[model samples]
Target: MNLYSAVSKSPHRSGTCGPNYLQRLLRLDSPGTQTILSGPESKAMTHYLRSQHDVIIVGVGTAVADNPALNCRIEGVGLKGQPRPLIIDPSGRWEVESEKGLAECVRLAEEGVGKGPWVFTSLAAPKRNQKWSQALDKVGGAYISIPSSDIDGKKDLDWSKILEKLAQLGMSSVMIEGGGSVINTLLQEKYLHLIDSVMITIAPVWLGQGGVVISPPRRADASGQAIPAARLHQTKWQQFGDDVVMCGRIKQ
Candidate 1:
């Protein structure tokens, strides 16, 4: 699968990697819409990609909003060996006791063959959250401190930095399932070059709400207005259940 191929090339020069491939998948409504979007096909594709990738990443926003297990589940098929759940928790708010926190989720999934989640946070995390760290350890989940783009309380991160860290930790690839802003940064023109492939599952319905939008590639026109450039050049599309799956590669 190209999804696997893209991430397989995600390691570093100091380590082993087949090729440098960074891929992303998101579900969207129509085109240029920001809202909740997903269907049966998208669900199936999401599970498959999460299971296939070496690591699954969701920014803290998604972690808080969705509380996803990050495990592959397909009705009767069940989850195979699930990939590691990587949380971009710049604020250190994904505590074990935080209702839908990954720590608690892992504990609930402990009955199955699920592995603990891996939380990555900024160095500026509040010292008071030591108890949160303890809770993570209690559930087999671990928190790792990484570089941050911290400005006051507006903590952010460069995905490239985390990708480098993952490479060192023996993770050759990663799939980012997100909550908008994070994916927007990665897919922006400057960082877009880093991504190897793009896959999106589009549902037939529309949610006009400004929840979170999975943006497509864009470029500035002669008038300096950003316009929607073509998506992937070589893309394949398929209809599954109530949604359609689209896959394509980022042009080098």
Candidate 2:
């Protein structure tokens, strides 16, 4: 199965600016402040991509910050037809009580429109406090245990193991929407080989360097020649409202 990591960024390459920062940038009454980077057409494209994949995955940071429904809302696709929602929470820090995203998934299931989410956590996470257990019980939501690695003092999920498990569950394709860390990690040397393609939506606004951004890794060849961390091949671009979506395969 192939993995697709999608991200939306400002023209300056910033991925996200917190609510307060974004609010400060635009007129308070502007309806698009929160979603300044993703317009209607871009959103529809995202939903279309979700409908085409077997599962939609996001990091725990995104799950908490956006509290996204993560379900496909495109035309003609019913609840059951939506891709499964998955979150990578290696330490099991997700709080179902506060976050509405998972709850939204369950509500859809109650209406017979969709199923709940599957949270991928580390085996070391506290077994008794599986907070996702109760809500997920109502809609066939599950918890998957996978390996984790330490990246600069932070514990992150092992993409290789996660992919292997997804394949075992019969998932043919997965789409990754994220917090900046997840997108950047997938493009780094360690996990770059696992990604099949990347789709980035670029907005016209510039967020400058203070906002979140993609940081490519720097490395060198055997003879000490500088080499790019990663590269894209056969790139394609299309406009979606005020945004431009660039799609391409990761050069292997």
Candidate 3:
């Protein structure tokens, strides 16, 4: 499991901006702060990430909330082959609503690339949104599930089973991105093997009730005390313009 975070930032703000006059102004360092990752750097990072991971995983909240197109073939970073797209939709709700959800499946089919637009849900089969299932089926994609009971006590969802299924479809590695709860669950269950971060330092803008960037939940023993610390291997960082990309491996 190779986890990665892909973020773009400007000194004026902390995320990417669309092409416009204002965006050009924001990129200038007149105010003593600079955007990290020039347009070229961002394109390179996207290409690198797509090449590195066979599968990319994100939570339902991310799928629904951000409605990200989540594909690798953006303008400058042409995806050589499609990487598998995986979504952890425990409740089976996101498939029906998200435009990003629909686009991810459709684009893969249109491009005729990669293994799947896979959905990892608690449901054993696809539901009422048969249109979504049909779209995926047309592209040789699938919806997979294991018993939710298996995940009950920080027991780890049967990631091995999930990996086996992906292997059958030819995926060799996975990149897990998140919307906090899923990140917390994966960390607590010790399911992650590596982590990558595209660190963004912003202009202190606050969204008082927004989701947390990282939330590694603690597991408690029977007496309710936190479990002992797990060893973290080491972290490596690379400069992407003024921002940093940090990667860490979890020790076995």
Alpha-carbon TM-score of each model against the true structure: 0.75, 0.81, 0.64
Q: Which model, 1 or 3, shows the larger TM-score?
A: 1
lDDT of 2: 0.65
Which order, best to worst by lDDT?
2, 1, 3
In terms of TM-score, how similar is model 2 to the real structure?
Answer: 0.81
The root-mean-square deviation over C-alpha atoms between each candidate and the true structure, in angstroms, is 7.0, 6.9, 9.7
Local distance difference test, candidate 3: 0.48
Model 3, position 69: C-alpha lDDT score: 51
| Candidate lDDT values, in order | 0.57, 0.65, 0.48
Q: Give a tens-digit lDDT track for model 2, residues 1-252.
A: 113732212000111222212222222244223444556777676767777777787778666655567688866798756988888888787765554344566667657677678889998887735455877766878788998888767777888777777777777777776655676777778877677677777767775544555566786889999999877789888897777777777788
The residue-by-residue lDDT of candidate 3 on 1-252, one tens digit each, is 224432222010011111110111221223322223234454456545555566666667666655445556545434454456677776677653354345544455456644456777764534547787777777666667744535555333454455555556555555554445555565555554333332221222332332244445566778998874333447565565543444445555
| Candidate 3, RMSD to the unseen true structure | 9.7
Q: Pull out the clashing pairs in model 2.
A: 79-113
Which 10 residues in a row give candidate 2 its minimum summed lDDT?
8-17
TM-score, cand. 1: 0.75
lDDT of 1: 0.57
lDDT of 3 at 226: 86
Q: Which parts of model 2 have CA positions greater than 4 angstroms off?
A: 1-35, 99-102
